[model samples]
Target: MSTVTLQEKKSYRIMGISLPLFGLITVGVLTATYMEVLPKGMIGAFALMMVLGLILNEVGNHLPIVKDYLGGGSIVIIFGSAALVTYNVLPESAVEIMSNFMRGEGFLDFYIAALITGSILGMNRELLIKASVRYLPAILGGVAVALGLVGLVGAIIGYGAKEAILYIGVPIMGGGMGAGAVPLAQIFGSSLGVDSGEMLSVMVPAVALGNAVAIVVAGLLDRLGKTKPNLTGNGELMELENKKAEAKEEVEEKEEKTAINFPMMGRGLLLAVSFFTLGSIIGKFLPQVHSYAWMIISVAVVKALNILPREYETGAFQWFQFVMTNLTGVLLIGIGVAFTNLQQVIDAFTIQYVLLVAVTIIGCVIGSGIIGKFVGFYPIESSITAGLCMANMGGTGDVAVLSASDRMKLMPFAQISSRIGGAFMLILASTLLRFFI
Candidate 1:
């Protein structure tokens, strides 16, 4: 234990010393973005550097334009890489195993549990962010409802409850195709009696196809929307104007402030540890223990409770960001490495397998798109969100899809609504299907 602690400290120290190197790279890249002439490989390099830049920021340093742009960019990188890997668009072995373990009746236990836990934690975080923020109450309340449903469904269905689980995870993870093949594997496992090894390979292509389906559908929607502008409503115009005003205010505030000072690292670390422990305790006691869910939820809840003051110290925010960034990085990197071991799954794709994937993709696009339209989002935005659900087939994808579409100037609230509905159905349907199929 002592050795490990020492090593960890040493690693952090090394990271601290190495911060400037990353900052330098980030600055160089930012200059390019400003000039609108960033090279190709620089794009990937920039994405990778953003996370490092945030770490540097936490430790107290500045690297010109890099600090501002790259830090936030890290969030994007974390999101995008996870999306690519989760959907099997990227050939990473760790994703294969995790996705497999994530699939089916057995898989639902952990994920659904996590969904519940994350919401609870997120609410606590929301409270910390601002109790008066009008949106927090409703959102947190919805999360509670979703959590309860997930736990109830998981307890009753067991491993067969994967479809239900996917529905839940899909919205949470990244929406549609990014939601990935865990649900299909669940279905295949229970209904077809397919082995885990065989199912892993079956799911990869399905995930990719789902994502592709989403993109194509979204693109088509974009084209269609061009012909009928603002069919989605003009609520976003107001939102955009407000955001711009907020940005200007923030810029003025930054000028008045000295060096950015985040809160101490201790608080976030303590909160993270608390949540991890709490999750473990809850997961163990739950009828069908899903520890990961507990861990995730606990983290969010603990952080929320600990950090939700109206006037948080700068150091506190910095530490909290660090903790979250590190947590996300470790989990994702672990998933990436883990997927490397599942080569067998991809080696034996059959005709039936191909068809199954095709159908799933189609279903995701059509289902998600219809839901988006009903919610009054621009067609492109709705389709992307739908595609995210249908393709990678998860919430993270939903966020990414929505965010991506927003970049393309599409209305994204539809994405949010789609997720709310899709996640509920995805989990419930998947779990219930187990018994009949």
Candidate 2:
């Protein structure tokens, strides 16, 4: 009689769990959640997020139109979770636990810390140095154009130019929510003698809608790159005509071939957290600057100086890969649950607001693309990083935008655009409020 071998048996998997096992786990999680007996903290948070994220990811990636045009699984996990919460499909207690774990308990920071530390250290020293010098100008170009275009459009439509720039334009390009809208609201409120909460109510929707637009545009850019191959460098930001660039690719290939080292990843975890801690300490002294910007500076300095041993760099990269591969879906779900407000996004969809937001994003693309090309960087990559990333919602937006663009390797530059560029926008908003108000 024919017998089925273990390998020959049919099996399906979702997020590494066999199909049946995944279903059972899902049932258990749902049962516990409904019974109000789900374990607290990380255990419960992870279980719910993983199950929901994986399911949404699978559905999103498989749907033909969504997979092709709408940013695939990443967008789905984010907005799907947001929709669930908006409809109150998930219990309030579950949302609270997830939100606490993600924001209150600092899961988002943990994810970003690993990405920044590992991505910088793992990069070629020469490329890192060359790219850094040119990045700022590209960012500035995007900012100038986005704000200027939106202001012009607002004036044309009788929407009040100052209102457009201050409310919609600044917040859209200001980074994300915590680092962008929240601070910008305070600045505007204090300067104009208005309540910060009231100002925030106006700015929050712009940030959210801008974030959504950035993700969609990133996917379109990815498609454009495919159609016009010369406009993009795949994951590489710059189009360098040097052997060093080639050498970087070889190093990356070698890294991929290297065996997984658990101990190395452990060391990587420690190094990432330590660097973040250093940034936090530095941020205390420079209260104006975000700790993330400080962390990027610190990590970049170390990488540029070649201060660490080669093994440590490898460790950091490995750890980053581990976190990115496993936790990204979870993190996206957290963002949707904790940060996104579907009702607010809907409320802010007036024609004038939508038109102004569209203009700002377009200006960012045109401005960053032109300047980036001038600076030897690929236009698509630059626009995605210095432009769309700047226009997105900050750290969480960075993740979504990069994921939509299929350029997760561009995380370092994306972070720079979010943290540093966002800080610059805050300063600009404060100065402009004095002039406009």
Candidate 3:
């Protein structure tokens, strides 16, 4: 008899399903979708997104150069899905379902609500207050430098300084599409007596291209941090000199001791939704501020005042971890399929246009990094949150950029840049159009 019995093969999985089973499920889903017999609403939408997202994510993370420097799976998920849609690789019916689920049904909002509520609630109260006080100035520094640099380059390249600032610089830094560019198009149209659609035509490409650049640069920055460890705080945004390292260690120890509680995650979900609801209600009253900004403020206030119990805080953190670990790939798929327009990005890739966008991003990085250092934050973290976050496409862009940088903990600051910084751009654009137009 043979001395050794046959060894069992190890199973490989994607999204928790073993490879063989997952392949069968993927085939069935695609067949159903192709035949237009896929179930409607969340059931159909979630299945398709999950399948596409996991496949793309796995491939992206494994590619050699792409994994090392090009934002790994995060970049692949967004642009890969965008290319699929652009090339008609995905069925139109399937695309429509994904779009409706992501935008029409507000899946992005639900994900962001949990992230913001949980992230803020779980933060150290002292660090939160200290960082929040200085964050706005860092954001302003990025905006100022990005716009100025783009305008200077535009004039040098004969692209027209004022037009470059208005079209390229402002849109790139104005947050994302809905909160930033759409409103900006309306403002520009009314001021210049042109159609808002025309204004959008020019701005949309800038947002898309800027978002792509932000993701790439974020990945590069992460690599830079690894090579030069002093440049980054890992995930910690600021250096709290007065705060003892032992205290942080103690907190981490306590966190490790707390086992994952299913009921606690349920409470976390409820809390996240409730805070988001409160933000919406407040937005109704304060129409000028974005609901996300209000939500950040509300969460910070609750945290600062110690209004919530410790258990609830831990619960929120647990929920955030769960969503971040599992749903990020799915969300990236939604963003690519729904928000990105590959054709627009390609059409806008003139030498001058590329240079202008690049200059804007570089300026943002330099300016925010310098200012952020003065205010006690690590340069890499500041540039990612205050600089690249501002230049990327609003909420979706924030997630992508942070994901690329491996700094999901900075969600609170990224939201501030997208919502508050974007709101500021609208005001600036409104004021500037008066003179330029």
State which candidate has the highest lDDT: 2
Q: Which candidate is the best by TM-score?
A: 2
Candidate 2 residue-wise lDDT, 1-437, digit = tens: 98965445478777656777777889999999888787889999998998898999999889885664445676677779989998999999999999899857878778878877886677667645555577888998898899999999999999988989999999999877655665566567656777654576677667767777888899999999999999999988878673244555432312334578999999999999999899879968974555665776788788879999988898998998898788878887886787666666567679999889888999999899989898878999999999999998666678878988999998878877875677567667756765785
In angstroms, give how far residue 226 of model 1 lies from its true place: 3.0
- Give the clash total for candidate 2: 3
After superposition on all CA atoms, what RMSD does each candidate show versus the true structure? 14.1, 6.1, 6.6
Give the candidates in order of lDDT, highest first.
2, 3, 1
How well does model 3 score by local distance difference test? Answer: 0.78
lDDT of each: 0.38, 0.79, 0.78
Query: Model 1, 337-379: lDDT tens per residue?
Result: 2322244434424444344334444444444444435433333
Provide the lDDT at 392 for model 2: 85
Q: Could you estimate the TM-score for every candidate?
A: 0.44, 0.72, 0.70
